[model samples]
Target: MVRIDLKEKEAGTGTDLDSVLAKQRAAFNAHTNPPWSERKANLQKLGKAIEEHAEEFQKAISEDFGNRAYEETTIAELLVIKGGISHALKHTKHWMRARRAPTALQYKPASNRIIPQPLGVIGIISPWNYPLQLAVMPLIGALGAGNRAMIKPSEYTPRLSDLLKRVLGTIFTEDEVYVATGGVKVASAFSALPFDHMIFTGSTSVGKIVAAAAAKNLVPCTLELGGKSPTIIDESANMDTAVARIANGKLLNAGQTCVAPDYVLMPAEKINSFSDAIIEKAESFYPTFAGNKDYTSIIADSHYARLQDLLEDAENKGARIRVAGDDDKQQLAKERRVPLTVVTETTPDMKIMQEEIFGPLLPVVASETLEDSMQYVQSHERPLALYWFGEDKSKREKVLTETISGGVSINETAWHVVQEDIPFGGVGPSGMGAYHGEHGFETFSHMKGVFTQSRFSQGKNLFPPYTDKTRKMLGLMKKIL
Candidate 1:
């Protein structure tokens, strides 16, 4: 069961949104501007808190996800969060440093520089899939960029949210980092609030709603939405290595990851071998997923049902279902457990082929040629991530250069998201804007341009005198310099 703690209500109404916003507004007004050193200190302290609670954070995620592997959680959530913080700490000083710019000829004796400043208070709505990492990492960015924050963690992972609230309470005052916990109603209220900036991580459908609500206030937002990400296995790829990497990535968090390989595209002749290899590798990783403790988890009962429904629908439409583990109904139905399912001979009209299967289901489509596979991906919405496995450098470069995705990986899956140096985000339907490393700090910051000039009159001759001499002088200046 999930436990919630809401602030006491006022007479004749629920908790007051006006009061909460007042507190935030007051805080923002008091600290209208802050120095770079203070922002760096706060960010460093937050990073220390995260490191101190690393074990607790990992355990909370494990409990929430039922059978989440400790190592996987550490790699996927903990390490990613740590890496984001560490990267921010290392480069924030440089990121915050004012950048000098050339003064325009019209503005003589003036010096210009771009200063990255905070956007006051930022609101973050994190999804349940990666509650700990997603929630805290963005906050790190906001704080690093010198902004106050309010976070709304998904109610689906209520336990983790409670833990986060407690942890944050120890390290920060409510004015520094506040947490609001409730169901969808609270989420709606939170999104509707006029935050200086907002960051949302969830499905594209829900993202649309958040975007629409944010539009009311003309609030800037960084949305990280999900889509049907594709993995292409070229003919020159190492079959064994490709299969292992795909299986490892797909089964992590039971495929509840945003960047997990949603579907695979390969030559028609290699489909059978690839499918067999994936099943073999999956069994090797978890001898019995129903009883195996190494494999991670599913979100909840409803999600399990939804995954089953998608599979059933595909099966009813003549798609072949291949199970990597035991297919016993009783075992599968236990709690939120579902075996890794591989679908083949899929048509474009099938629901599974068209939708993002946020479960341990892998869809394999055979294409007549590499171009056919590329065309399939091109036809769909731009994905948050894309993957390719092949030995031919030329072919790999061609795929990478030709395609447009939020991020890409070569010969592996889901590893690009962990590269702290590169920016992580989506484009078009997948998502908008990015946040991680310097990109993250910039997202939460406003680059204000400042110009300083000496009070010297150097262009007195060009003061509104519409003569041929003046025009000729202006033309000469423009052409020469």
Candidate 2:
């Protein structure tokens, strides 16, 4: 049996999360199922708010990260969110419509339909990396499904979180969509709330804690956690193209992305060439690391220290380190940027190989054959995303079938996430549940199966106490079925 472990007050917020939840719940109860027009208006308002506050958000996020690229903020956060809102606005009516389900022959003339209904208040726990996107993407789904929501943005990105709270507050009522800002204590309390549903995006370790807290209230959760997402450069892959694409994905956000290529697996023969090409590619992308506005800084001091520690551990474990771009202490002091470092000669025991390298460090592992590459990925926890670059259709098909991941991109990286039509999520420890576009609507809405019995329905035949006639009827029905 699940238990409720909520506290009277959340330490970080210094407010009663219980009362806040009660307010949202009360509002939702008063207006149970909002009409399509109202939901559409809400979505429109949200999109407008995001557009109006885009610069503010960019500034606040940059402050949070020391030196985030403005274009990265625009492209990765604002544009992606607006696109999602546009997609939701265009298709939400259709998504909300009752889906026709075929009735069985025994229940002929009876109509079956699956109705999607709001799940009341949803709680969102978003991470620091891509704070705006992770927090609002799920909120988009919840709103599209006509559900109210409360968001808890990461404390690490306090400025962005505060900005989000203020911006959202201007457009939405507290009871409609509340942004709760605080540290770990507030996050802990927020996760323990008895929400209708919850969505969390962060590391696997923290995801487990949030899942456990939500489970205490028996609230279903969508966990968008991270793992060692792999990139495989098949023998048939064009080294130049693969190298360029991987470097683009891996270096974007300074490799702080959850779905960034954690490591690379390639055939032994191509290791040296691939390494040289990627280093050159990284250098070309950011001519110099120091004072380069195009390059993003790591989020915090601890994170920067953590990346250095990972490198140190790997090097001590006999892994070779190749640094690309200048390593300037001035840049580190000002922006917290770490130049792209590629590690080779990695073993399974090395911390860099074992842990999710959520920084600008890439470990290139050599595999003797495609089977060896496949075996390496399969042996580890299924990743959130996988990239396989090759022109060979047969090899691509083989990788697609034989390997598993939350999502896949062929001949590219991270682009699969922006495709609004498909579901995006992880398979195992990487995460659970998918939400994007229509999938997002379904995740936040409960699909209730409804059957309207016809006046002449035969469903009653199996409802009463069994008799000889009923038994005969059941047998006949079974034969027909």
Candidate 3:
């Protein structure tokens, strides 16, 4: 059985950010670079706690979001985090191994090694969407690398954040893991803390603020920010499969996913057909959106209103927008639900096209040619993810090579972010740095480079300015190496 520290933790864990960081830093000092077995044990205990308390988390997130689908919380948040824990535990030993590097000829009998050491303390700032998963996933990496962590969950998801604090308090000492909650002020304060490493997952605009704050402390950060991820449907694509995948990714959290295809690029002639297919696919998937348990709702009045403004702005600018249950705006509004909106005839001047549309608004832009689609992607800041749907091997390879994104899901969408073996991150405005699986372990680690030299080696021969022997050695190296 995994250990759950049953001692009652003190209240106000979410209030004092400075105390949390100081306590965690002290804890890290007490236990610097914990053994692989301990790290593995930590991950196991977390996984066990999660497995036992999954339903509570699901319910808390549901409450926090007004109506986030329970199944989404289960599949996207809980299950995915469980997978991360398992992966980290399994591979931590190998990840902890010091790698020996080759030495230069001049440094005969000398060797170098790269040792991965735990950063003293890590700070994680997770977004409201997929709150539990985003917060805990990075914690997995920090613990797997033997670093104490302080997580600042989003202000929007108060219930989930509180639950996370309570749940984690039961399982871990505050120093080992802490959750601090508040609105923008608390978040700003948390960002200014002198953490060893910081990870922020949210919008690019806020990421900049976090980055600036972290920079003042000279703390390195991994920014998992949002952008307009594109999904391209080629002429040779299987229309139905493409539509289904896009629908799944976009509608996962009522289109709140950072990696959801913000826009669709397809051949101009196939625009109407693709739009029709997506509307049909969305309807078939969730026959009733607003009152449906399978469908998630907008978390706040502000976000819901923002989505409305985006829709109105798009329509006013001449985009054809279709909601899931067309003509049920009244019902949708009552539930804080916005259906999958397939938008076409979109232009760059529109609000939906300019900003990262964090709702179920798909801006379908007509691409006259494959070059046009690729060029369109290039014109903007790199995306968090890029999806291409087609079987043409050469075209697929071209798209992969020509475009840049944080990740890619060829013929699919959003699923690539969960891979334990790979790094998940973004580029340019999308964000920077990556963390997942062993990559996460490394990201939170300080890879200290160590060089060892044999006492009797000739390394000291070149220590002085102008020795004949040093000249000979340098000449030989230049000629041979």
TM-score against native, each model = 0.94, 0.96, 0.96
lDDT of 1 by residue, 1-481 (tens): 3344432231101245545666776887898766768877787777788778877877888787777777877888878887887787788888888899988776667688998988988999999999988998899889888888989898777778888888887888878888777677778888888889999999999999999999999999999998988999988888999999999889888899999999999877888888898999988888887756677667777788789889999999899999987656787577567767899988888889988999889999988777888888898899999999999998888888888899999999988887877889999999999988888888999999898866783465577756776787688678757
Instruction: Give the number of the best model, judged by lDDT.
Output: 2
Worst 10 residues of 2 by lDDT: 1-10
Candidate 2 to native Cα RMSD, angstroms: 4.0
lDDT of each: 0.84, 0.89, 0.88
Q: How many backbone clashes does candidate 2 have?
A: 0
What overall lDDT, based on C-alpha atoms, would model 3 receive against the true structure? 0.88
After superposition, candidate 2 runs with Cα above 4 Å error:
1-15, 329-334, 463-465
Error of 1 at 61 (Å): 2.0
Model 3: per-residue Cα lDDT over 1-481, one tens digit each: 1122222132233236778778888888987979988888888888988888888888988987878777889889988998898888778999899999888776767889999999989999999998999999999999999999988888777777888888888889988998887666677888999999999999999999999999999999999998999998998889989999999999999999999889999877888988888888999988988788888998887889999999899899898877677647788888889988888888889999999999888889989777999999999999999999999999999999999999999999999999888889999999889999988988999999999988878766678787899899779878867
Task: Give the range of the ten consecutive residues with the poorest summed lDDT in model 1.
Answer: 5-14
Q: Rank the candidates by TM-score, best first.
A: 2, 3, 1
For residue 158, give model 1's deviation from the true position in Å. Answer: 0.5
Residue 298 lDDT in model 2?
A: 87
